[model samples]
Target chain A: MSVHVAPLKTYIYVFLALMFFTVLTVGVAFVNFAHHAPKGIGNVLNDAVAMSIALTKAVLVVAFFMHVKGSTKITPVVIWGTLIFMVILFVFTGADYLTRPMTTFVPVMSQ
Target chain B: MSENSTLAHHFDSYAQQKESASLGMWVFISQEIMFFGGLFLAYTIYRWRFPEAFAYSSNELDIGLGLFNTIVLIGSSLTMALAVRNAALGEKNGTVRNLILTMLLGSVFLVVKGFEYAHKWQHHLIPGPNFQFSGPDPVHAQLFFVLYFSMTGLHALHMIVGLGILAWLTAQAAKGRFTPENHNYVEGVGLYWHFVDIIWIFLFPLLYLFGRHHLT
Candidate 1:
């Protein structure tokens, strides 16, 4: 098998993009849309936005910096497999917490 | 048919040897994901249980320093990528240069993290009996710091290991041991370094930016 070398420019581009996304994540955090929408939904939207940008940056690093885009056939299988299991773990565990009934853990001392 | 001495005896070709080594590294990384995944799961459970406290606790962290470290790690990943690129192209000096830069950036990250940790210590944010927070639920806030220290501490350990690998790679590059035809060692380390960076990519937002909307 032959080696596929990524050009220098690609790495530079990815570096810049990652930096941009990093700043973008911070920038998004300071912007609040809670006044326009329901408070709970707005907060969730903000968290989702931040995480989505992070996911994009992770993909760029994996595909380009780590050479996953040009990697051997078996490599992506491992990458995808790891990702699937991670999702399963988080999703399964999150289901219990997200579905749990709300309870007041602190009892009022004066009530 | 081992053209390269680095090639193992059981391998049929240099390419096969390289491929297997790369795969082994990825498998190891996958295991690492599971390792860190457990911590993330714990974080999620606690955040779900005490969202308000988690949000307030996250705001107590210094975003400026967190952002700075993110850039530093990203810069290191770029240098690591360049090191691999130069190694694969048989550019000896370029490989050495990038390897040194990567190591420097990695060290800078650790130093900044050390200072951050020290700040936490001074403020008694170490999440124990003396822990202090002005947040509504100090117990839940302490839980946030517990996750914070464990996750970032684990990530820092990986950076240290990565620095050691880069140091070894720098020495090897200085010796002109890698060539366009045989630089799987460099490539393998590149994968490890990038995987570390990816962990921080997720970590930066989760640890620092997750509930930051409360700041505004």
Candidate 2:
């Protein structure tokens, strides 16, 4: 059987997935898995969860709304061109944040 | 319109014209993503330094409103897509109706968001100048509010612009300007509107709903 798909159906699928994501995000937020998890998990689990959810949503938006899903080579190339520059920017700036030498001022204790 | 003298007399054919317009809009959307990327980066750095405070500040935000707004924007995005589809199918009336719905939905988002901001302002929830909420580390709390406002405020501005485009498109549709062979505006506007929705998708959880348990 030759199966045919409509664009609206695809959009509806995406919309439902987004609704699911909303629940997942809210639920993940209430869970005590992050470093600051309402005094529960002492690790960075919560942060990890939050970041993961965010990344998923970002990917979905880019793939669908931007029409990168089932896209041709030329379009992907254009998107990647911009992404390359963005990545380069993030790299240098992020490295600066992590590598800055911290000097403890420690108010001089005068005898 | 025939391909000989009807392809806008500019492009080789209608298909080429449509593809080029879509490509151009995609490029514009990429730049927008990068624009918001800057704020998200700042938010990450600050969140790392003051995780607890970010969590605290996030909880105070109305998560329900944020979630609801997400739905509204998503629905608008769909309507925008329908506008493009109608334009491609030579359905002038469908295009106008869809554009109106899309634009109205965008306005609803702004109105709802305005109410939220008003509530925040009344509570002195905005960062700086008598930020009333106190409980968590005050400095970190303030950082959260700063990020919240910057992210959401920029989003609201985009919504306003999207409404403008939608309005223009609605007017053009009323004049019967779009048909199967001519819907560049509809396609372009759809791409822009969808991009705005995408930005909010990322911002919603990051700004309004993250780090929940920690605060309560």
Candidate 3:
């Protein structure tokens, strides 16, 4: 019932990859997309790129460093379940605010 | 049973015990994800509502410290993974050495983070009465700092807890409690340490690096 331990070299590679991604993210943050895109679009592009990179790094950490890659079947299911729940939580809550009428708000309480 | 006293009687084999432990840890981690998810959602809401202010406020953060601490955390994760690997190899000294190294690296991260917090205090970045954000919308800037402190503070709390676990594991390693066949505890700790590192991975981009382009 012992888990399959990753080879020591695998751990090293994963660490190096993580470090590389970290530097990459920081480096990419310096790029000025404002030069090529409109202000709002540029900010979105910047955020999208940075976020995509961060998500990739996160996957590396979870799958390799955390040994989720070769873990039991149930482990991945639990992991996916958590991820799905998070997506639902963020999307639903975010959509509510994102789609709201900018002018609509409850009146402030009377002093 | 099987000359390994660590094996619980309920488990049919060492593998069963390890599997059970792994499953339990994953479940716990899932719950932790939800706990932090709420915080992330709050951050998303505020960021959506006040993007410019959030970006401006983020620029005030010490990117140098943030980057350095990011590396420190990644290095700690490596050391943590090594500790578990050493345990799986049944090398008691190796496990102890790596665990100590991991703890030291985690401490370094916290120390740097402490300095960053103090710097924020001196700069009046705290989100209370003394808050002083010099950007266009100081009010919304306060929102940024609120999320920043809350998220990173929670993360630091996890690091402290992880350090405590590493200390305990270090003691166990010194006692020769971990062998290649019975090192689930070490693996469990590795999962936790790596998870903490993952949180920082997202935090680095979301909080520290988000508005850096404007500054440059």
All candidates: CA RMSD (Å): 3.0, 5.0, 2.8
**TM-score on 0 to 1 scale for chain A of candidate 3:** 0.77
Q: Of models 2 and 3, which has the larger TM-score?
A: 3
Q: Residue B37 in candidate 3 has what lDDT? A: 92
> Per-candidate TM-score, first chain only?
0.79, 0.65, 0.77
lDDT of 1 by residue, B1-216 (tens): 546566667988888888888899999999999999999899878787889999998888899999999999999999889988999888999999999999999999999999999999999888777888887988778888989999999999999999998898899999999988789889999989998998999889888987777767
| Candidate that would win on TM-score | 3
Worst 10 residues of 1 chain B by lDDT: B1-10
After superposition, the stretches of candidate 2 with alpha carbons farther than 4 Å from their true spots are: A1-5, A34-44, A61-66, A101-111, B1-6
* Candidate 3 chain A least-lDDT 10 residues: A102-111
Cα lDDT of model 3 overall?
Answer: 0.87
Error of 1 at A65 (Å): 0.8
What docking class should model 1 receive?
Answer: medium
lDDT of 2 by residue, A41-93 (tens): 55577556766876786677667655667556777888788789778777877
Off by over 4 Å in 3: A1-3, A37-41, A101-111, B2-4
Each model's DockQ?
A: 0.58, 0.32, 0.57
Q: Estimate each model's TM-score.
A: 0.93, 0.86, 0.93
